[model samples]
Target: MSLLTALGVEKRPSCNVSTTAVLVESQGCRSKDLVNITACSGACSTYTLYSAKMKALEHSCSCCQEVVTSERQIQLTCKDNTEITYTYIHIDTCGCLEVDCSPFAHSETTNTPSRMRSRRRRR
Candidate 1:
């Protein structure tokens, strides 16, 4: 019954979190410990398509973003041997969500060459 999934035709990239090592520094001070940073990444669906019913272009956009974040503080060793606190956002969760693609929104479009010409003329 499932043609897409059972046939392995569904091959969309999933949004998820990725990890990397980063050096944290502040005010000439750097963290003495190795810091691991996690970030939201990957491709979410984004498209611009022509709609026959509306006689216009439609754009749908979603992005991988942090759904939940936590504030974290770290101590950095300064040149004077004093410890300084630095705050950063730690990504707790990530998901795909709709983002603002255009000022015209979903119902309206701004991609056609004719429309672009009209806009330039008005300006």
Candidate 2:
């Protein structure tokens, strides 16, 4: 088993289930590192949005032009005494949010024609 599997942890790719939401995961250790846990716990001062307009929240993330809709903070204490925290952010994208994992994946995409073909064939 890999280190993550042995530790009861696994990393999955980011996914967007709708036009205004995305799911992502991250893991870190508390004994050797505290920053990751703190950030995931919402202790970090990241981009926050209080506006209803999607365009206004586009600058929340420096790496991409994503509009923030909501945030969920989670904290956990692992069996190994490691404190882990996870922050899940739901954002809006112009198109499909790609694997670059940043404003790349999208629930409602307008540019990819293959997306329509795939959906139609599934029926």
Candidate 1, residues 19-91: lDDT per residue as tens digits? Answer: 8898898899999987888899988777666678889877767889999999999999999999989999989
Clashing residue pair totals per candidate (backbone < 3 A): 0, 7
TM-score of candidate 1 against the unseen true structure: 0.68
Q: Residue 68 of candidate 2: its Cα lDDT?
A: 38
- With a 3 Å backbone cut-off (N, CA, C), the pairs that clash in candidate 2 are 96-105, 96-106, 97-104, 97-105, 97-106, 98-104, 98-105
Per-candidate Cα RMSD to the true structure, in Å, reads: 6.7, 20.6
The lowest-lDDT stretch of 10 consecutive residues in candidate 2 is 36-45
Runs off by more than 4 Å, candidate 2: 1-25, 28-66, 92-123
Candidate number with greatest TM-score? 1
lDDT of 2 by residue, 6-113 (tens): 544323323322332222334543233232211111111123343466653332222223433466455545656766776655443322222322343465765567
**Per-model TM-score on C-alpha atoms:** 0.68, 0.21
